[model samples]
Target chain A: MQLQINNKTHEVDADGDTPLLWVIRDNLGMTGTKYGCGLAQCGACSVLVDGEIVRSCVTPLDSVIGRSVTTIEAIETDPVGKAVVAAWVNHQVPQCGYCQSGQVMAATALLKQTPNPTEDDIAAAMVNLCRCGTYNFIKTAVNEVAGRKEASL
Target chain B: MKKFLLTLIAIIVIAGGGLFWFVTHKPGSPFDGETASAAPADLVHRGEMVARQADCVACHSTPDSKPFSGGLEMGTPLGSIFATNISPDKQTGIGNYTLADFDRAVRHGVTPDGKRLYPAMPYPSYVKMTDDDIRALYAFMMNGVQPQNVPNKPSGIEWPMNMRWPLALWNAVFVPSGTYAAKPQQDEQWNRGAYLVQAAGHCGACHTPRSVTMNEKALDEGGTDFLAGALLDGWYAPSLRQDHNTGLARWSEDDIFAFLKNGRNKHAVVFGSMAEAYNNSTQFMTDDDLKAISHYLKSLPGDPARDGQPWAYVAATSATGNAGKPGAQTYAAKCGFCHGTDGRGKNEWIPPLAGAASSLISHSESQVNVTLNGSARVVTADIPDAYRMPSFREQLSDRQIADVISYVRSSWGNHGGPVTPEDVKALREHTDPASSNPIVLQMR
Candidate 1:
């Protein structure tokens, strides 16, 4: 299978049912994408499949065979992704950092699609689960990326 | 005879004066002459660091609640006791508390109004804090934290149990009132580690066994059972002692330090209640402090008889399982995919079942709890892991859960012993699924 990840093309041998998370982590060695809940309940494996946030753990390799997959590694290349990453750092959003790649990916996707998201839009779109309960900081980071003042805790 | 009498009188007078001085004199605080306004910024910053070391935020605040506006419910054998607001709110929090009141409450577990506090506040450990630390803590609480007027919640303990007077007597008997004394026999690093573990870090609050009165079975190194390990909140905090199997005997100092700093090492990953501590507290500690902790923990001896034999990995030939046994079949069908047919999990991400503490320890509560309800999300450095264990409660029957656990325990050189169906049922009834929202405290 051929996949476009981080603006680079790669040919890999994996089963059609193999989760993109494993292919990225084990086979391709792009371990930035975590394996949180193999069942898409947690968005720890969130990635951009043609600009839409998809839970890579549940998204099979075949589904994104020819699509552009943007991960945490390449999110910095785009202006929106760069802004989100900067906001994340400014807010000190990560605690354990295992779920951050997915979080960053999800946030970037939200900014790309909505550009100016309301609290309700953010609440609805940013569904990635954080065990550290960093949602408050995450909201602040998103607002910062959206060129708004940081929300008070 | 006259000369002898005069000499005796002089000796008596001198001895009496010395005794009086010893009894009356106490260490004066550096801030004794200064007012709260005169407290230096550096001192307040130090105090904030100390607060983090003490993990004041972990119990004092709830997720989405203002920091230090305590409302976290602590479960006790008696009942649930809510942590009181320690924020500087004038009406509802500790804003009115004088420094002396704060001292007494923190070190002696006595309120300003002479009410006794439960040991759940861990004043026994706090008693060992130096006067300087106490002064700084008071300064920080007064100045650094934002005042929240959140009213305190009353404990659910009934009648006589709720009566606080007995706690005064309990305090008198069990609580030691003084700062930590450095042991002459140990090095500076060792003593620092001791002070941090016994006082500020309050490792014993979870690790040490409690008496019927809920007093820690031992306070410090003087007691053999100190840090020997205990069961609390359905999880067993493994011994910090040097037991090869259940404790840090096999782990080097680096391993301990790594676990504290990074939350996971080659041995195991932090989960359950410890994940919270790692997320909020230990990960922020300096490398020197983490090393000191490791040094102190490693010095403790393990209980050989209690820990049993050290574990060694025994490889299984194939991914396929033994047929006919329902327990083996259950393991193969349900657990084998992720855990592997051999029972050894993949790397640090998926913890290996072979020689895993949850599977090998005598305490079966954690095993049962995780198996039934699955794990709470492990978020370190704000990054949630991509993988988590899904809840098996709905999918597996109590008997099946018991069988699978028993099979795991007996197999792969794991010797945690058998768990009965009744045990699973009891845990099933009491425990709830791990909430995706872990207790995250935003300590300023």
Candidate 2:
């Protein structure tokens, strides 16, 4: 089977039902994506599939055959992803960087789809879990990328 | 006046005696005069096969109990009753039961002491089992199975209701006599299929509707009611006939065979009680036998009037556009990952919610119960399923479950109507997820 990952088409040999996370981290040797809560409860394995956020741990390989997948390895290639990453660095959103890759993917997808998203849109799209309690920093970073000021708390 | 009184007294005496004799009369068995002989190894093996076909262990034993040691409590309208021990222990089990005694109990639903077994034994359907199968089953029960010393639990029904004699009268009206005779007109495969279904398989015990008297409306495909679907326990056992909406109108013979053999197919995966049936009984069947059963089930026609319009999938308006709807956003967040935003599941692994029997049928119990309790693990060939629906009773409230279920039922061309929080609440109280989890039997 062929997979389009980060602007390159890679030929992969694995069962179709195998999770996309396995193919990405193990098969392609791209370890940027993190695996957490394999049941899709936590979004640590989030990736951009055709510019939409999807939890790759639950995404079957067959479902992403003809689509483009952007992992944390190539997040800076896309313009929106670059802005999201820049905002993340400026706000210091990673106390522990394990969940930031998925968090960045989620913010990039949200901003790409809704350039000027509301707080509700941010809340709904940025649902990834960060165990280090980096939510306030992550929220401020996404709000900056969305060009909206965080309301006084 | 004196002559009338005398006649009335005589009539009362005779009627009372006749009723007593009817209830206490023990039915004679084919092996009535035969003694227990030493069964060969192959006969015991064959008997084991027959027991599998009959799925006796399903109700006969609890998860923690020894096989056939019977302590599963079955609920009845009147009260609860426990399944009796069928092991070969002389005091606690059927160890002392002679060939005649065993035959009488298995086929005739009568113990050697003239006590009538409850209809819950499914003796109505077992009556059609062939004499050869009965002999093999008896041989296996005596020789193959080890004796368990588990004592039988008594019924919870109070005095007047607990009396077993009334079941004798119930049996005479509802139960039939003798073994199945193959129809000459049907082909060999169909007859074999029919015999398995009507006799040993006893599919109608759940699939067929019961009357006011609590007897199955029909015993075989000769009546339209056979395998037409009915509610048992809490789940609605969907129609096995050709009904387009609530039945297997869309499923092919291969699909049915695959479902029974592999525990799933493109259309649906086994859940609810069907999961247990798959794990304990159907998966053990031979390939040819499964094919025959599938063929026989497919032959039963569905009623157009009862089935209503066939299901056709219609795409949900929009994933984000329908966010205003009660359950749309919740579904996208919770269900869309696996069940897809479009309700089409990924391949045969996760079952599709669109055009599903639970989504199409009016009864919302199965959908609600499954959502609240989740599904039992469908372990096929000793491998557990990769994906399972997790229980949401703690995470979601009753209204949330109702809304999400209603949303699924109302969407994708499904006609199952809206569900209320009350329905979800009722099932939550009545159901225990631990009980539904089938312990894979090791019947060595």
Candidate 3:
């Protein structure tokens, strides 16, 4: 299988049914995308497939054969991704940062679709789970990128 | 005159005998020589308070599991031992236990059936609880808790190692069966901190190093190792002692209070096992109690020779053409954006990597764990944080991660030393990403 990741195409031979998480982590050794629960319940393995946030742990490798896969490594290159990462750092939002890659991806995706996201939009879009419970910072970072004055709960 | 002298002699004898009895005779139980009385409603309330002081729910309850249902598996040198259900269920929990049974179990580390419990239960410190407190604890466990039928899981310890008899002997040597007596020299706040740290908080359980026999090296401030920190469950619980880099030497009393209250301060945020402690126990502490804890912790002196010179931040000039260096490019590409080329973080939120404890500590476990698995969430007051360090495990090779870490450690006057790829690989194999559902206990 040939997959485009971070704007680079790679040829990989793995089972079609193999989850993209394993393909990225075990086969390609791109571990920034974590395997939190393996179940889609946690968004730790979130990655952008043609700019849509998908739980890669459940998304099979075959699903991304033709689609462009953008991960945490590449997310920074995108304007929205860079802003989200910057906002995250400025806000000091991470603790035990296992779920952060997915968080950044989700936040980046949210910002791209809705440049001026309200607290409610953020609440609905940025649903990735963080064990460190960094949601307040997430909201703040989102608000900062959106150029809002008010804080989100 | 003779009659008067004889009466006086009889009175003196009776009084002397009474004094002797009072001094020598040990009270067997709270109920001894008193008629059986029902525990008052207020006593049950007090019992609940006592249980909270002990922080029983932290270990006894699993995340999203029933309170005190006791399924949390604790790792030991022998094997893993699951916490038992103490929720007063007759079939599986401690519902069938009498007050005497509770006392023996809590203080003596013995079960109703004469079986010895593993020392992991913290009964060594609990033995210091007063009889009244124990009675109240019994009342709380019996009356306050909702009984659950969750069956206790048997330990995974192998046969000879799993045998309970040795623990009795171990207890005899290590456990002190007496209530805490306040030191006359210390102030009330210090005494309170001492009581809470030594008994209820069980700070030594994780922070204090263990003996070859798996016993806590020290139980009180008298021992240098107490609260000096030990590695547990893949993360190093840095010393609560006064050690400059690794301990609380640099933390002010206010810093300590703030960390306890808010779960994060300028220096560091609570993560790993401590996140659970903050979520369930420390955040809810009274302000006075938090102050007292800080006061007590600050009294501990640091080892100048071991802790080395106090860390001073040194400014770093950006070196051009450093991309040729093994880790320099990785740092520039990966870390420098957040940490900066100077290695000083942007603000209080983005902790400075230069002289940061995570990079400066002798143990690289924390760094490796965070770099590999990423941190758990840092929730304060039920609000999740927004910023998070993404895991670099997949993006960077073990060698790359090690190289970058080494660069961070050696640079900006950080003296923590270099970490090897082998070290990174070992930690990566053992550790998992921080769970989103940290053990947040909701104790009533």
Candidate 4:
């Protein structure tokens, strides 16, 4: 299979039925996309498919061949990714640092889709399960991302 | 040629002398790995508190795992590493540790013979512990704990990477110590609880989140989310803060004290990390300390908005009967045999299901998971007879499991939430029922 991962094309060896998670982790050596639940019940395997946050655990590799695959690795490359990471670190969004990559991807996509998200917007975006239950921080940081002028500017 | 020879001889002599001096000056430093700190009373007392604050017993003293002899295989992305014996046994434990040696191991994350302890040991969190606490912990281990001859099994952490020294860098950025200082603005009980929860107990070790560096983001007061809640291992340690959904939003000060003291109260029941806390740490605490913890917890005002619609049990359609639902039927089949028709569990033995804290807490996850997986049999000293809630994995399907849990939650005065089969299935995949022969070991 071929994928435009992080804006770079790469040929990979793996079954198509396998979730994009294994391809990123075992095959691509990008350990950033964690495997909290292979079923996507926990959004720990969330990544960007065409700038929209999708649970990579449930997403098949073959389905998104021509589409772009953006992960935590390339998150810093995108403009929205910068804002999300900055907000995450500044407000300290993560607790166990396990569910956060997905949280960030979701929040980034949310902000990209809607620059100013309210509490409800954040709640909807943060459906990912954080065992540490950093939901409060998640709400606070995304709120900061929305209020900050940099998000739009 | 003559000058070059003379310089070489001078360099060699100085280098040899420097090595000799360096080795002698740094007492019990990394260079000298053979030192031992004998068990002293002071060391023992301190170690007791340090261990309590760290909740070391929670994981180490499992049903089969010897107390501090460390056979409980804690799970991680890096595979399982059984907790090690810190008992003073010369053959099987750290009876060979010196003060500085223990200090390095405790606060610095270095082991007695100069190796790094994995973050799983919570050295990253302990790195914030003060020197005094470290010394006291050393004293406690050296003196307080009985010696055990059980050898520590090697951790499953694979080759070359298992080397401990690299953890030094992980520590440098993340760990910073200086015992908790109370907020002058907050009253005494709150301060006391904060101190106990953060420092003496190091509750945040499990309760707080970590940064990318794997260090606890904020140790105490500076972070609003401190002691709020975080997930560790398989269980979710609910927020110590007064949040509505999964925290003590509606719990009173007295309720907190009761839960900590006896393990069950009207608002919540002790399960998961909390049960261990009750079995080992909180249950052993003095009344004043419990009150103080309660008082502190009470000071945290819950976000009424998020805590949302306070739970009120709707009267059963018949007022005195189980609703004719799959949940009710499943409850009768597997659970009602022990829990009673009313959902109130037996005292000290089978924890009551109705109106208990876990069921009352808005988030139905813990309630559903515990019912499906059953509880880890509590084992304390002198009480060899322990009771375990058996796993329903094979006997019940996800829908059946969800119905049974939902029946318990909604039946009596408890109002947790209506659980879905999806929730049960998710937990079923993630969790394995606790062992009847839990990893308990004995220190000599």
Candidate 5:
């Protein structure tokens, strides 16, 4: 499989049916993309496929061979990623580090597409499972980054 | 060969002796499931009281979910670990657990057969629970709960890290089993609140910051940071102290009671973990207990240095051209429907964002997150209102959110810190909308 991860191209030897999560984790040694639920239920395995946030746990490696696969690692390359990362630290949004990268990836995607997202927008997008249940802080960071996105524009 | 044999024999002798000493000298476990030959006549009654005091059902159970069936996934720094099956079903749950097993899990941070439990179990706080409460909790969990056939989900923690034996050492360092003692001068209410919050409820599990060792910073009121709001699980369990921003500065005892009882009042509604606390613990609490919590919370003094300047709204032009100012326009277009133009909502229904303790926090972190994701659905009392704040993920942009939120904060004399778009983006990536479908695990 030839894959573009965080803008870098890599060739990997893996089964086509293997979840993108395994390719990123076991094959490419990209530990940053976590394995949450292999099922698409939790957004912990979320990554950007051609700038669209997609749950990688369900996305097959075969499907995303050519598309840009953006994980949390590459989020800062985009201005939206930078803003979102800043907001997360400022808000201290991570409880356990496991789910954060996915959360960040989804947030950057949201900001890039929509400069400003409303509370409702936040709800639909940030639906990752946070067992610590820090939904309140997530909203604060998203709103702040949205403002910053506007300021930059 | 002689040295090896001597060492082996010595090892066996030492190991056997250690095992004997361990059984004899182990600190009495609070949740041990060792059942006495004769059952206490009021074991079930005591268990009910203990369950209420600890608010055990809040995290272990879900709204419309199973009671103590343990399917709830608790997110930790490691990974999302599902709460274990506490119900007594030998095939699937803790049916075979003895009283000693329950005590170790609850207070000693050990499972049956001495399996160490993760700190996520809140044993650090639970260790403060009284012996009687532990016994009661054991009785309640073992008997009151409907035995579930649900199998326990393995934790997401990777291999060597998932091992539980190390937790025994962790407990040795942190867990201290002692009931809360009342201060000589403080009244009954304060003591009651202290006991409930510190021991049974384990509010500090979320409210207090953790150390490098993951132990809660301070166990009691000795440390000023006890319940003094540290960011956790994404949301800051805003200071329980009476601070201008992010504390109980503006809430009267009655207001606190209202919020706790019904999940929403005039000021704010509980969401996130607090929402669960309300659904499982606070709402069911007796009126006096709520008042005790209020009294305890109000006594905590705020730190002006940490809180920063009180929020004063001087409306600026909205960043978005869609409305008068982006902030005001967003508020007018979106928020006004529920919060109203004045920032006040219907009593005990939609919460007014004005003068909310959370809105006043020096950091706009919690404020930004909640507005973006909307609130956990509140269905309390006989009134099950379907009017939830819709997810605008498809609608507004982040800047639009900031402007509107800034307007609300400033407009209502709320001195909450100004929000930044960077903050919005970070949380967007960091968080997901709370599931509207409550993880209700029905155990029977």
Candidate 6:
């Protein structure tokens, strides 16, 4: 099967039902996406598929056959992703750095979808879990990227 | 007056003797007079296939036990009864028994010593099995299977309730003794399918409702209640009939075939007890047999009155409109990713909650049980399914489960009705081994 990952088409040998995270990390050798709760509960394996954030651990390889998958490796290429990365660095939002990539992908997808997202919108969209309690920092950074008044909460 | 009293006593004696004979009598078997002999290799091979169709091992063997060395405990109203060892061991199993003994036990629910086997053995359904199949099954039991020296466990029922003679009367009233007669009106495929479902598959053992006496209401499609859906073992097996909402009205013959063959279809995936059937029996059936089963099941008509309004998907007007409702937020956070916000699961991989039989049926046991305890893995063709419903018992409260299930059952044109926290509580306590006292339904 051919997969469009980070704008590069690659032929991969795998079952269609194989999780996209497995194909992305093992088959494509892009390990930026982290595996947390494989049941899609913890969204640590978040990746942008055709501009929509999908939990790659639950997303089957066949579901994204022709779609573009943007991992943390290619996040800075997009304007929105670039801005989100800058805000993350400015905020120094990394305790373990394992979940930061997925967090960055999630924030980029949110800001891209809702450029002027309010507190409610941010709360709804930024549902990815960060065990290091990096949520307040993530919210502040996402608020900065959205060009909104810095979120006090 | 003394002469009249004597006559009355005589009459009473005769009637009592007749009643005793009727209850204790074993039905005659064609193999009765024959001696035990080794069966041909081909007959034994065919017998193995017959056993697969019957799914004999599902109850007869536990995970750790040797195959056919039955020790699985089944809960009944009287008490728990253990499935007897069917392997041909000389002492512990049925090795010493002749072919006639096997036939009587399998088809007539009678032991050689005049004990009546419980209906849990499903001999009512097995009675429809052809004589040839019985011979083959007997042959396999004697020759193909390894003789395991596993002793049969006694029933936990106490003395008076454990008496077997009454069940002979129950069998007489409820069980029909005959092989499946081909309906000349229907095609060969339908007849073959009917034979499998009614006889070997014994689908009605779960799908058909039981009477107060614990007899299945209907043994075949001749009765409307046959496969009309029944709740058992904490799961509601949905109707095989063609009802639009709670049955297979929307599923095509091909869809049914795919479901049986592949363990999944676009409309639903095999879960609950059906997963065990699929894993052990249905998936192993030949393509032609599956097609025949599909053709026959499709012929059973659904009742409009019983099924109520047919379900069709009603698109949610707005996400915000449903946000205020109980369990909405829980669904979005916990379920929406895999099941989708629309409740249409990811295309054949994850089954759609919208218009699903679990959601459409008024009996919400399947819905609640699956939600609270989660589903068993659906393994198809040796490959475990990519997705599975995770257990939420520890994560969510009984109220949360009820609220979320209520939200699902009521949403997306599903009319499964509201499930109360008590409903969730009962099943939770029942399924949880730590709770100790599970509510066991006393089958009258």
**Per-residue accuracy of model 3 over B311-333 as CA lDDT, tens digit each:** 77766554633445578767754
Model 1 segments beyond 4 Å from truth?
A1-153, B1-34, B318-324
Which candidate gets the maximum TM-score versus the true structure?
6
DockQ of each: 0.04, 0.49, 0.03, 0.01, 0.01, 0.57
How well is each residue in B1-444 modelled by candidate 2, as lDDT tens digits? 999999999999999999999999988888888877899999999999889889988888877888899988999988999999999999999999998898888887899899999888988999999989999998888888889998899899898998999988999899988888888988988988999999889899999999999999999888999998999999999999999989988999999999999888888888888888888889988999999999988999999899878889987665534567798767877787778878988777778999999898888998988888778778888977666676778878999999999899888888899999999999999897634344576555
Please provide, for model 1 over A1-153, each residue's C-alpha lDDT reduced to its tens digit, 9 standing for 90 to 100.
Answer: 899998999898986656788998998898889888676666888898888787788566766777899888888998999999999998999999888988898899889999999987787667778999999989999998887897556
Which candidate leads in lDDT?
2
Choose 2 or 3, whichever is better by TM-score: 2
Q: Candidate 2 at B101: error in angstroms?
A: 2.2
Encode model 4's per-residue lDDT on B226-258: one tens digit a residue: 666565655667667677555776578887887
lDDT of 6 by residue, B237-331 (tens): 99999989888889999999999998888899887778778877888889999999999999999999999988999877776366668998788
Better of 1 and 5 by lDDT: 1
Clashes of each: 23, 0, 27, 37, 79, 0
Over the stretch B102-166, how does candidate 5's per-residue lDDT look in tens digits?
A: 77678767666656677778888887777777777777777777887877888898887787656
Worst 10-residue lDDT window, candidate 2 chain A: A144-153
Predictions in order: chain A TM-score: 0.96, 0.96, 0.96, 0.93, 0.93, 0.96
lDDT of 1 by residue, B348-404 (tens): 555567787777788998888888888766666776654566688998898999999
Candidate 5 vs candidate 6, lDDT winner:
6
Q: Kindly give the stretch of ten consecutive residues in candidate 5 chain A with the minimal lDDT sum.
A: A144-153
Q: Give per-residue lDDT, candidate 3, residue B394.
A: 72
Q: Which ten residues in a row are the worst by lDDT in model 6 chain B?
A: B435-444
For each candidate in turn, the TM-score is 0.71, 0.92, 0.67, 0.59, 0.65, 0.93
- Of the true interface contacts, what fraction does each candidate have? 0.04, 0.29, 0.00, 0.00, 0.00, 0.39
Q: For candidate 1 chain B, which ten residues in a row score worst on lDDT?
A: B23-32
TM-score winner, 1 or 5? 1
